[model samples]
Target: MTPFTIETNQYLTQETQGFYHTDFGGVNLPNNPNYLYKLKNDPHHNWSDDWIRQSQEQLYRVLLIDLPEVQNHIGKNPLTICVVPRAKADNTYNPNQLLFKAGVRNAIITLGNSFIDGTNYIQRHTNTKTTHLRQPIDGYNNDGSNPYVGITNATCNISNNVVGKDVLLIDDIYTRTVNIDEDAIQALISKGAKSVSFYAIGKTVFNH
Candidate 1:
C-alpha cells in the first residue's frame, strides 16, 4: 500500500507528519456505514476477543507492508513509539494499544518494550463531549482553552525527560480537526522530543 502524507501546522516551528492506509470517506453514521465508522462507533461494543484477534491480524498486515516505508522516511534516528491517549472513559480496554502491540509483534523495525510507552508518559485527563456536527478549531476543554491545552500545559502529566528522543505517535483515526494528535505532538516537542511522526489506521475524509 502506498503511504499518503498528512501535513499539519498545529506546531509553529515543526510540522507534524502523518501517514495512513486509507481515507475515512465520511462520518460513520448509523445510516451511512464504512469500515472506520464501524470501528469507531462500534455500536455493539464488540471489541472482544474475536475483535481483538481480527484487529491484530489487520494491524499486522499494515506493519508488515508499510513499516519499512515508514522506517525509510524516519531514517536512522533512535526511535520511541507513543500513542495518543485514549479518552479517560475508554481506558477500560484500549483497542488502539492492542492494535499497536500487534504491529510491534510483526514489525521489521527493532524496538524494545521501553520504546512503546504511551500509557506511562502522556495521558488524557478529561472526556470531551461527543458531537457529530463540526465545530471551530478549538480544544476540548470546557474552559475554552485549546482542545489539548491540558497536554500542552503539562497538566495531563507528560514526562519532561524525552529531550533527545524521536517519537512515532500512533492513533486509530485521523479527523479534520486533529487537535488531540497535534497537541500531543506539541507536548512531546515542548518536553524535548527531537522529532515526532504520526500514523493512523484511517484518515477521515468528509464527503458532503
Candidate 2:
C-alpha cells in the first residue's frame, strides 16, 4: 500500500511520512470503533494474552509488508526502531512498549536483528496532562521549563553513538497536531540520528 506523507507544519521542521493500516474516525465515534484505538486507550483491559496475540498479528502484518517499503525508501542505511515513550504514569510495562517489542521481534525474524534495534532510548521525564481530549498544541512542551517536555530530557540508552544512524520512530497513534510526534523526531535527531521516519497503526481525524 502507498504510504501517507505527514506534511510539515508549524511544529515540525521536516516532512515525516508514514502508513496506517486502518483509519480512525476521531474521538468518541461510537458508530466507527477502531481496534487499534481500543488497544491503545483501554490497555488495562486489553492487555490479556489473547489481545496481545492479536495485536502482534496485526503489527506483524505491517512489519512484513510496510516495513520493507520503508526500508527501500531509506536505501542502504539500517534503521533502528524506537517507540514514542509513554507518559510517566505508564512506566510499568505499557502497551506501547509491548507492541513495539512484538513488532521488533517479527522484524528480526524476517529482516534480521541488525536492521532493527529495539531500544527504549526515548522516555518521558514526568507525567503531563493526558492529550487524549486536547488539541495537539495543548500537548507537552520542550520550552526548557515545563516538567513534562515530551522528549526534551528523554534518555538514550545506546552504548555506541548514533551519529549517522537512520531511525524508524513508531507510535501507536498519530493525532491531528504534531506536538508529541514532532518532539520525538526532533529529540532523536538531536541525539545524532541522521534522519527519522515515523510509523503508526492509525491517524486520528478530529471531528471539530
Candidate 3:
C-alpha cells in the first residue's frame, strides 16, 4: 500500500512528512482485520506468543520493503531511527514493553547501517495519563499548561546524541486530536535535530 502523510501543518521549521502503512481505529470498533490494532493490543508476554510473533514478522516485512523509499525521500544522509516513548515511565517497562520497539530493532538489524538505530533516543521519565482514557476536559495539566508541553517537559528526555542528526520518529498509531506524535516531532526539532520525519504503523480512520 502507498504511504500517506501524517504531518498536516507548519508547526516545524522544515515541512516534516509522516507516513503510515495501514488504517486502524474508526467508529466501528475493532475494524475488521485491523492488523495494526492487533499488533499493538497483543502483548508479547501475557498474550498469544504465536500471534505476537507473526504480527512482528509482518511489521518487519513492511519496514524492510517500505523504509528504503522513506530514506530516499529524505536524501542520502543516513536517518536516525527513533521510537516514540510509550505513555508510561521508562522504568515501568521492566522486561521492555512495546513489542513494536522490538520489531523496529529487528528491522534495523536487517537493514544494517542504512538506518541508525536510535529507538530509545527519547526516554520517558514520568508517567502521564494514557491518552486514550482522557476525559474531554483533560486537555491540559493541573498546572494549566499545555498538556503536550507539560508531558514532554516532565517526562521526556532527548539524547544529546540526537543533536544535529536527522531523525525518523516511529510510533504505532496516529490520531489527529491526540497530538502526541505532533508534540514528539516538535520535541525532536527543539532538541537540535537537523530534521525529523515520522512514520506510524497505522493511522486512525474516523468513521463518523
Candidate 4:
C-alpha cells in the first residue's frame, strides 16, 4: 500500500503528546471575523485558539496549494466539500458549494455526515485507537467497509455524480492505513469525478 506522504512537520517540532493543546480561552486571531468558516469538528472539544491556527495553516498549505498536482491529473470541474459526522455545535452551519465563496471558483460542493454517515468511518475503539483522543469530540477512520457500519461511498453524493471535477477534500487528519478517504475517492470516481485530493492539518504520530 502507498503510504501518505508528510510535508511540514511543525506539528512534530514540539513535544506534543497529541495534536491539540490545553483549552486556554481568549486566544487571539488574525482579525478576520469569518476565519472559522468550514470545519468538521466534534461536539466535545472546544475550538481553542491554537487548534484553529494550526488547522487553518495546514489547510492553506496542503488543501489549497500542494494538491494542485491532482488537478493537473484530473481536469478541473469544481470543488466538492463533504463533511462526515458534522459537529453538533456547528449544526446550523452546514456546508455548501462554497469553493467560489471561499475564492476558489464557481464550482464547489459541501455536505455533512452525521452519526450514520457512509463517508468517513472510524474503526478503532476509544481507548485503543486514541482517535477519540479528544474526548466528547471523537474523530474516526473513514475506512469502514461493513455495509452497516463501514465507510460507504454511496453515502457521499459527489462520489457517483462528479464526472471530471477536480476535487479538494479538507479534514482534520490522516488515520487509516488503507482507509476511508481512499474509499471516498473511489466513490467519487464512480460518481464520474475526474480527480479527488485530500488535506489535513494534524495526523497522529503513530498513524505514520
Encode model 1's per-residue lDDT on 53-114: one tens digit a residue.
Answer: 66556655665666556657767344566666554433533565344543544453434432
Prediction-by-prediction clash tally: 3, 0, 0, 19
- Residue 109 of model 3 has an lDDT of 86
Give one digit per residue, the lDDT tens place, for model 4 in 36-116: 332333244355656655544544444344334444433343444443332221223334312212322211212212111
In model 3, the number of clashes is 0
Which residues of candidate 2, in runs, are more than 4 Å off?
26-33, 37-48, 94-97, 133-151, 154-160
Of the candidates shown, which would achieve the greatest TM-score relative to the real structure? Answer: 3
Q: What is the C-alpha lDDT of each candidate?
A: 0.56, 0.60, 0.71, 0.35
- What are the runs in model 3 whose C-alpha is more than 4 Å off? 1-14, 26-46, 133-147
Error of 2 at 120 (Å): 1.6
**TM-score of candidate 2 against the unseen true structure:** 0.71
Error of 4 at 24 (Å): 21
Regions of candidate 4 where Cα sits further than 4 Å from its true position: 1-43, 47-150, 159-161
Instruction: Give the range of the ten consecutive residues with the poorest summed lDDT in model 3.
Output: 137-146
Looking at model 4, report the run of 10 residues with the lowest lDDT sum: 15-24
User: Of the candidates numbered 1 and 3, which has the greater lDDT value?
Assistant: 3
Instruction: Name the candidate that leads on lDDT.
Output: 3
Cα lDDT of model 2 by residue, 19-112, tens digit: 6555567546753324454345343344566765676676677667766776786563577777775544336445654555556556656877
Report the CA-based lDDT of candidate 2 relative to the real structure: 0.60
